[model samples]
Target chain A: MKENYYQPEIECASVETLKALQDERLVKQVKHVYENVPYYRDLMDKKGVKPEDIKSTADLHKLPFITKADLRDAYPYGLLAKPLDECVRIQSTSGTTGRRVVAFYTQHDVDLWEDCCARAIMAVGGTKEDVCQVSYGYGLFTGGPGLNGGSHKVGCLTLPMSSGNTERQLQFMTDLGATILCCTPSYAAYLGESLHEKGYTPETIPLKAGIFGAEPWTEEMRRDIEKSLGIKAYDIYGLTEISGPGVSFECSEQSGMHINEDHFIAEIINPETGEVLPEGEVGELVFTSLTKEAFPLLRYRTRDLCVLKREKCSCGRTLIKMSKPLGRSDDMMIIRGVNVFPSQIEAVLLNEGYTPNYRIEVDRVNNTDTFDVYVELSPEMFSDTVREITDRENKLAAAMRTMLGIGPKMHLVAPKTIARSEGKAVRVVDKRKLH
Target chain B: MSVKQISVFIENQPGKLAEATRYIAGHGINLRAMSIADTKDFGILRVICDDPEQSAEVLREGGYITNVTEVLAVGINDAPGSLATILEIIAKAGVSVEYTYAFLGTRMEGAFMIFRVDDNAKAAAALEAAGIKTVEQSDMF
Candidate 1:
């Protein structure tokens, strides 16, 4: 069967054709970076490699990997491909460590981004008739505008509702007969809570599909969100540096997110050794934008670690599918010489009937790493006595020990006592210096 | 004849009530009488104090959400049927007492009871017309 959606020349393009397209684009991007971005030029010169040496996509391995620190070094606007006036739109990522990293996009870049988004929407069986309610934030963030423009490209009735104001979001979802919703998975969970509070059920909102991403979510959360909202939740993945939230998407099969390989090449490489790993092997994900115009990336190492599967999907797209990112390299906490991800703690907390609000404090006591978890009890569990609380905390400690190989001291705090962020939740606080 | 009353919304927890009372006491607000109406989720802490304004402000600022309401502080005789007489008058006037608790007055001749009803103004007026003295904010403080 001939796939109408797949571009014949690109999707089924021969290796020679693919390499030619990549080479042309790669050379242009390299020259652009060398002329405009001093960071990339200096890094390339230090590695004793010239842009011409990267003649094929496979030769991309010769290029130095660009890390988040490189982006930080460049800071705002230091990596732009075009002049400031030519750039039409910009999006920034919330830098947990310092100032936000801003990405620039020309009109052409925006069109390509929207096309990628439209493809993502189509992957999940969304059509022009579907009403897309975009609940992702619009200002300074790539999520809202990226999905909004893409939904528009797909000829859907787009609602750029943005985030928060749950009452109004529900009102518009019901009033406007919205069918597709987009937002962070956590916000989706909160929306489910709001719907229950207002005595509304799955039948209340005309939602049939959801594209959730921006933050790490587990399969358990996906199930909860799907069951609560009565919608098929598909994971969409992207970063502002690459082109925002339409870089890849999960189809109706829910197998994995299919990367748009024609535009962006996805590679899994061993994070420690920087060696490319074979398909199905878990490693850090790296991408080289083959079609991006405004700020084409060359081997940008997204610290997100995941595996890729090249088997043909039931969705008939020849693109590569990536398993959900486990966690960022920087997000992994070394407690007592054992690596622990906050997501693991979160999963344990969710199953333990504790509220998701939590804080992890790491200190050095007696010259050893002492991990203390401050968990907020749910409203139902607030009345538990000190004995009961201690028992539950001990149970959590045991579970953490079994799961993470390092037991942390548990501190039960009152509900809503932990600080809440309007953006990403800060998970780790290292206080070894105080010791 | 008058007594101060304060209403507070307290989430049902082990130490919330103690914490609220401690906060009020720390602010120098003398507790006159208190009662509570509780469900599984939350409880209403109804308190009569010597300084209603100060008590309410302290509780509110301390994050113990509370409201101040006027209630009749009738000097009921320290004997049986005195409480029944006041309640009967309220029931006859079509007012339902949601909750009530008593505290001994400075003297043994009377007791001050704090009542929480649906209609505070109507209950106060009806009790006053029945020859009962309703407390003002200044009278108790």
Candidate 2:
């Protein structure tokens, strides 16, 4: 029997109905932004668009695209649609880049955001009977608070165990028989390793499903974590700029994550030209928050490169699906005139039977690109002699060259030399700036 | 017989060796013999210590990647051609050495050479067949 899940009315809406909802929300949100947020209104006016010009989703292209730079310039409250008294909370980006993005949420906006997150939890087979442990970091970062609210919405026993304190995380997880795990994929992988170190097998853990996101992780990592934890690992994709991590989530199908069309309208556009691409064409993912109150981002460039699919999902949700992001256009590195992404390097390492704990160091020495990859040797490979280890490194370099069209100097480091993270793992270190 | 050799990976940076030695010394471990094999990026500090397990544990607690390998320790007279004699015997037996390091023995007339051979058992057989005196872990400590 098909199990009844949460938020069926919106999730299982037909295409016509979903489009109608998007059109209604898009029209209202456009007018809301145009009237209230002068920063976005100026951009719209510059683009020769008025609030009346955007009557439906069909006129979405008429508005100007908002990039992270625009958001950075706007900073706090520049893009806020609602008044400051109406806002309830704020979540900011890690500011790893130039400037941090602060997104505001009114109580209503938080309710809708949590509703989207509840849909994500339900997609992963979450219910009130299950114990849901949210391990994503809380405060400022959208990961923890977003999922925590969603878990509450699902009426599950929620453990707001923010990131860190692994020992306590495991203790509560085991003692409470937590059935659902949520956090960054890297943290999930770390927990898997820790569990093994503590001599606990997958069967000993009560977790049945994991909702992993907040960073771009490869499918190879998904399989590794699944094997380690004995749980179906689901990918949840969202950005703080777009209201944290409930924009989309993978269902039992696991092929792609179904975007909550009622709230978010996703589009793919050519990264270089800014021209919107048709469905199935891989390009930069752009999202327009349809129903956000405080910050209503329209045609916001996400910088993530992925494709979209409208194929019938077996799970019975008519929501459109977005493929796992291939990589971020902003994070793409051009080494020796060739485009390279850390995800590509990660895929190569995992394929060659190496753990995903590898670091890529790129530097310009004497006007030449010096690319070096330091990979942690697995236990089986650790026993190899220096010559044998060098041979393996050469083989890896050859494999990377075949895959990436350019060879990287591979160095085999001892296991665990590379730093692991409780959040996003730092995979690439570009030393060109120091030079 | 094979001697336990604890190898620690140290970055090729200033004071790394000193830091590792300080940690080991703080644990009250004494190195009986030691050698450093270095590359441009990093170095492997291999040592035969009074307590191999305890020394490795101490270095690991100091955040070093330490591995214990079974290495053959052979005694050779401190004279010209003494090292070559053992190498010739092992080569004649079709055994290959991965790496070798030596230090003055805890005696007057000879030095102790550590052999990391491709096959520890095969190397031990070759040395025994040639009537060479091999040092065991107990003998070294």
Candidate 3:
């Protein structure tokens, strides 16, 4: 068997060599941002700093932190390092909260992004002979095009199937003999359910591996997807602002996502104080584009909470490894002074063998946030008696109490009772009636 | 006589019917007669109730995930060949019946058969033109 394409680069590169490469790229990136992007220059000047004053990665801390609100304030192209005419492509955020923050990419930037994604694919033992099915949607949304370009660059036959229309996607997967699949983790679960509904087995499609990302998913979800699809699932992390879907990826070992530190610098910092945190501790993830020319962000706060490890991975990659993201800093719900994340609830539900179709109803009852978890029983578990249903609901409540440290009222609903989102799942429904 | 019937997609598990009934009673809708067609994965709960529209609304409000489908409630004599006559009329109209069940009318003088046909409007029209008493939404309950 041929060795993995990324193995040699990861195994052979020394710590000294990797640091030297990062230092050179950091200097060049700082100079380029100061000269080309007015936003960086203005922010740096306000802090009494010049591009030449910064020397190494340690000096990067003196710079002001860039928040998502800053990106929103700048709007579409105010932060681009290059003019719009020179840009080759652009990708936009979902804009679920506010205005969409668009990221521009020049031709060289696009090539580098594709190269990183190709390296990621190769880390999972993907070969040129493999057929990759890109189901992440092709539009201004970055995922579909990013994976499609990378798969093509890796010399694989790429299928840009995009998202939705599950039946048609399955038909193509079977007929095309796709070997590698890429999409959000939630969609993979839905596809698995669709396959079961259609009476198809795992052998029906020729899928050996899957790269799931675009939303925060738990380890339980990973196992569920792997078991349902009968394929090894790897997590890929990226934001459109930095580079599409190839900022970092997990190797076949599945320990942590290996960051391409040569192109992008990863840091974990205290989200509240903007103070840098020690490695191996969970904090907000921040990234700076070292090689991107079109839109090289300087210390962009990703709002995702995760820990980083600089020790070499078993895959032999000198690149830094980041633990799977826990949750978004902004999306955390404080219920009765207890911080709760929907992902935590999802993990508990999966472990209890319940389908992950649940809605968290938080209502202000008697001046307190009362939580009601409306969970839908699987079609196979539904029965004709109320006693059996309440018994199952009690079991779910017990599991939630043990896992979440607090148990809310549980309601057993029929299958498909909860509304399904075509994109991201709506996890929180706060009915506090805030005026 | 005609009866108002509602067809809902129910999962094959315990307590689902009781929950549905609780929701219906909470909304003050009376259950007249009901039958369930069960398969391995799903069960179709066909009900002839006093107020079907309100009953469906209550089920939906309680988050039952059901769909309201129009089914024909034909008055069949409690004798042999009565259902055959209605099926023959429906077949002649090029309508295919998916599944069906029988229910006792309110007065107990006759039997009413609920037919879940592919084309509800066409089948109802054919049965009415053939002089069979086709139940309407208002005539049910």
Candidate number achieving the greatest DockQ relative to the actual structure: 2
Task: Estimate the lDDT of model 1.
Answer: 0.76
Q: Candidate 2, residues A1-435: lDDT per residue as tens digits? A: 144457788888899999999899898888889999999889988888998988888888888999988887888779989999999999876332324579999999999999989999988889888899999889877889999999999999999999889999888988898999998777788888888888889999889999998765667778988999999999998988889898999999999999999999999999999998999999999999988999889999988889999989888898999998886688766565344677778888888999999999988653346899999875455442456567888999998886675699998886677899999999899876420
Each candidate: how many clashes?
2, 0, 11
Give candidate 2's error at residue A228 in angstroms: 1.7
lDDT of 2 by residue, B12-108 (tens): 7788799889888888898888888777766778899877887777777776777889999998887899899999988887888889988887643
- By TM-score, the candidates rank as 2, 3, 1
What is each candidate's DockQ, to 2 decimals? 0.03, 0.14, 0.10
Error of 2 at A115 (Å): 0.5
Index of the highest-lDDT prediction: 2
lDDT: worst 10-residue window of model 1 chain B? B1-10
Worst 10 residues of 3 chain A by lDDT: A379-388
Model 1 off-target regions past 4 Å?
A: A1-20, A196-205, A332-435, B1-141
The lDDT for every candidate, in the order shown, is 0.76, 0.84, 0.78
What is every candidate's alpha-carbon RMSD to the true fold?
Answer: 12.9, 16.0, 12.0
State in Å the error of residue A172, model 2: 0.9
Clashes of 3: 11
Give me the displacement of residue A14 in model 3, in angstroms: 1.6
